[model samples]
Target: MTMSVTPKKAIRVVVWGENRHEQINEVVRGIYPDGMHATIAGGITELLGDDVTVTTRVLDDPEHGMTEELLAETDVLLWWGHTAHEEVTDEVVDRIQKHVLEGMGIIVLHSGHHSKIFRRLMGTTCSLRWRNDGSDRELVWTVSPRHPIAEGVPQPLIIPGQEMYGELFDIPDPDELIFISSFTGGEVFRSGITYRRGYGKVFYFSPGDEVYPVYHHPGVQRVIANGVKWAYSERERESYLVTPMYLPGGFDRPVLGSPDGLVDYYTRELIEPRENAG
Candidate 1:
């Protein structure tokens, strides 16, 4: 029963950042001189090496550096936005949503929970209790130790300083809960969770804060890299899922129809009828 499978090409990743903090705040600039997106991309490249091609994008870039052409080529997109979440146009959010549903994987990091793309997909407020006065220690516990995203990650990944994100996390329950984080203030949050939207996979990891050097932590970087890999979809890219009809006794080829035609298109039962069925 052993079947040989063809290997896929290297995973293509794009790290999208707000880039506002590094530009305006000296402390953030000092921590991540090249912007957090670059750091995140660098970590993915460092970990995945030849297995992945990583690129950095920012909100300030034209079309927020998420052009249709670029997204078409991207296999997995890592988003990190904070102050400029509202600044992201609805058009871009719609574009991202379309791609995500079409099988492009997305990894939302930290404050990205509030981003339009995340909210649109989640259909909720995506809110949570948080503290940003620094001085918060986070212990990310691997709730799902056997999960692929938790592979090689420490049992209790310790982040010395980070912003607290506590529960009352206003979103649907995750398909998979990988990591749960406990902060110094005796609050716990579902730090790492995954969801499936159409043909795409979504992972949200809350850790990296602009003020703290959380991204610099090796464990944190490893988790993010692992999340990127796990989020990547192996299916052939499609514009969107479609219901293609098949003729009676014909299963291999679909009965394709023109987009302009409505009456010609038919919806058939997805499951073939059993010959023994009355």
Candidate 2:
């Protein structure tokens, strides 16, 4: 189903960046003087226009700028991180995970495959063979042309220079494969893919490296913008599996009394209380 956010109710997007590279590296600063998060958010705003309300957040912000209130209002979130994935606290990861399971969308970019949130969602190491040659060419080919994320993207999006990310990427099989990329060295990788965890949507695009001007590429920008739109959920927010949920669409049923047992939430079978209960 096509998810469209009207002008009256724009899709709320948050672009989260590590912001460490631009702060400490001159080369990275020259490419993204205002920080990569700003550039990414700007690209989405430029493409989606009023359809999306974009905001920028960074690792240095309090709670990584991902307060509960902020996440509650956000419909889709784009994540870009490297060098300081460990610095993102476990508490924040838990919050992000909970929100995602509750229906907020997320896009994990570039090296974010190794991030705690991604790894937790993927249930894998999220490892891959990589090289910082700085001159490797990347050809991003659309594998699933009919997918929404590939709407306006060309058959082959050519990137002149990029860090090589080879295959054998340690990740669970994605629900949908959107794009695959090949490096100059003949190594191919599943670059763009999507997954649904609980009520949330996820997209992982591997093209924007800090060392290169990949984010400035028009095609890459379009892909990210498209991803934001595609990731948004159209339905009203609904809580995930939790306690107090009754069976048969919350329908009430007869409760048969047992000597020392009660019906299970799922199996509807009688279970006895444990003797070692506190």
Candidate 3:
């Protein structure tokens, strides 16, 4: 007998960006007239349709595009940052981290690997060697050939003319590494990696080049769409493993406590600090 594969649930995504390059650089403006975040949201909207909702936000917004209220309502957040990573406020980062710990999915693109959320989740320096000459030809090798993220792609597909980001990227080992990038400049990068901190899943995909139309490519969009589906859980289940107080109220106490100890709500599992802030 064969079992049926369940249809994937739609993941709500927030297409977020620094939104500066479009205004400051003519090339970027020409490539994505509506802004990169809008373009990404367009791709996701086209792919997932009514099932998935795609919304856009920018750094210059009232809360730098990430507010506690907005994050509480977001399921997945796609971050695109280049020159304005430092401009993102610490408070916004905290809100995002809290949501992730509770079970949100995060996708970081290109230059966003250095963003605060990525660094905090990975718990590392999050540093990498890079070059912006814009001549690098990246061969995106789908190493985990059997992984869900590579489900429909040909192995070692090429995305010409990308920025080179070289490792040893100072990040905690990813829970899974979906793709590796080989550049024309003879540099190799662990370009696509995934990690889970608390109940959330995080993915980092490196394809968009600052001056190139990489994001507009259909293949890139398909891969990211696939990733979003892969990152979603079978059902959005609560993260906590087990708790004593969860037992039915007014239960008569066992005469000898049937092997289980008394429950203490005040004494609970401590979460790892979302940031290494002093």
Candidate 4:
């Protein structure tokens, strides 16, 4: 028998930016006058169109613009933080972590590898070698062409100028490695990688440095949009993914907790049941 599936509505996306450099550095400001988060959000909208609904948030916003209500409505979140990772409070990081565990997708971009949320999920220092002389060229080689995040992405996509991120990246092995980037300095790095945390997906793409107009590159934009799409979780949002107790012959239903007494799997009843236990 064929099972019918419901069509998905538009993907809800939140692009979170540090918005620090643009406010202080002239070059970064020139590259992204409206803040990198806005540019990133625009790119997702431009590529996905009606398939996605994108919104921008920044570090300066109240609660860093990542309230519980906002995260509940967000299917996927894109984080771009650079100089202010610590400013992101532990409370907000805790919330984001919980949401991710509950099936909210996240795309951590560039310097966001050092962000609190990414590191918390990664359980590593998430450190890597890097240079920012603005003289390096980046060629993002698509190592996994068939990967969903590599869709429409050109082979060896070139960026005229970028900061170099070298290897020895300290993190757990990625679930998938989609792109490897080679810099002019003869350094190579895993530029595009993915991971799974509980029911949520994570994508880390290290191309868009704020000093360079990498976000304006069509190839990079396409890759980011594809990452957003691939990272989205179709499962209904949950408080968390919990281990449920199931009774034999009642496999269709799952009991979240057995507060009163132990459940008898064979008999499908409670052992030493409490007076008010249902």
TM-score of each: 0.88, 0.87, 0.82, 0.90
Q: Identify the superior model by lDDT, candidate 2 or candidate 4.
A: 4
Candidate 2 at 125: error in angstroms?
Answer: 0.2
The stretch of ten residues in a row with the least summed lDDT in candidate 1 is: 261-270
- Candidate 2 lDDT by residue in tens digits, 128-149: 9998877699999999998989
Instruction: Flag regions of model 2 displaced more than 4 Å.
Output: 1-7, 247-278
lDDT of 3 by residue, 1-278 (tens): 99999886566789898889999899999999999998888888887787788789999999887887887677888899988788888888888887887788888898888898788777877898888786778888987888878877656767877778887788888789879988877889998888887788898998897688888887788777877776665445343434333334636421111124443333433322324212
Model 4: number of clashes? 0
Clash number for each model? 0, 0, 0, 0
Give the poorly placed runs of model 4, Cα more than 4 Å off.
1-8, 248-252, 258-278
lDDT of 3 at 11: 69
Which pairs of residues have clashing backbones in candidate 1? none
Candidate 4 clashing pairs?
Answer: none
Clashes of 3: 0
Candidate 3 stretches with Cα past 4 Å from truth are 1-9, 234-278
Worst 10 residues of 3 by lDDT: 253-262
Evaluate model 2: give its lDDT: 0.89
